[model samples]
Target: MNSLQDALYNWLTIKVVIDERPDDTAAVETEKTFYDMLKDDHSLTNIEVTKDDEMYYVHFDHEGERKKQRFPRELIEVMLNQINQQPERYRNYPI
Candidate 1:
């Protein structure tokens, strides 16, 4: 994979692992990885992802103000499907 694809796969892998095992010992490092990926890939800082019953919420700072966005669970599921199809792409992620 190219650098961008590799980075995205790694980031998504970290997100999935954190969601599945929030109490894992690698949580802190995974969070750092997530944040770094957001900054590098999307120019976003202070990023956080959270999920409720139906949506995934992304919170971040933009222009010195806090902003939030919601993504439907189905959209995330589509991304997860793509990730699952190429599991080897994500194998190098820490944790």
Candidate 2:
């Protein structure tokens, strides 16, 4: 993915990778939202959903270089603020 989206997606996770596979990057994540995917999909994001525990740790692999990334709580807050700011995004939409 492009760097901008990468920068955004990076700010949400825990652990290097849910499942370290040979075919995949060492840091991996599930396909579902972090809230649901925490337990069933992958071992990541197992922390309780609180303001204190919002910060997440993740791993990124770009150009064969794998590095650790910390998804700060601030980024999450920004997202939350964005969602809160845009009421239209959720109007009549599935929760």
Candidate 3:
């Protein structure tokens, strides 16, 4: 992968949405799993996870430039998988 893809994969933030269901333990567990896996694997310096009425946002720095990428909250897992398996798919991020 190129430098942009590499940097993004290494440090991008994954904003996850928390479902407001009292019995949605799976969502909570998923959020924790995602956070732990990313932290352990990437050692990111800018991990911001929040749950509000906003869409998913991925923020990162490439070289000396800060960038952001947005995604639907429901696509969190898909987005993460793509980031890991196909970084090229996000070459135009921040556009």
- Per lDDT, the best of the predicted structures is 1
Candidate 3, 1-95: lDDT as tens digits: 23433433323333222332223354445556655554455444464433345555666443455566664554445544655476475343221
Tens digit per residue, CA lDDT, model 2, 1-70: 2353353353243222222121222223232334243333333332322224756555544345544555
Span of 10 residues, lowest total lDDT, candidate 3: 13-22
What residue runs in model 3 are displaced by over 4 Å at the alpha carbon? 1-19, 49-55, 60-67, 72-95
Task: Arrange candidates by TM-score, descending.
Answer: 1, 3, 2
* TM-score winner, 1 or 2: 1
Candidate 3 vs. true structure, TM-score: 0.39
TM-score of 1: 0.47
Each prediction's TM-score versus the true structure:
0.47, 0.32, 0.39
lDDT of 1 by residue, 1-95 (tens): 23543544456555665565455546448667756766766566676668799886778776687887766676556644655687576443444
Candidate 1, position 74, lDDT? 69
Question: How big is the positional error of residue 64 in model 2, measured in Å on the Cα after superposition?
Answer: 30
Q: Output candidate 3 Cα RMSD.
A: 12.3
Any residue pairs clashing in model 1, and if so which?
Answer: none
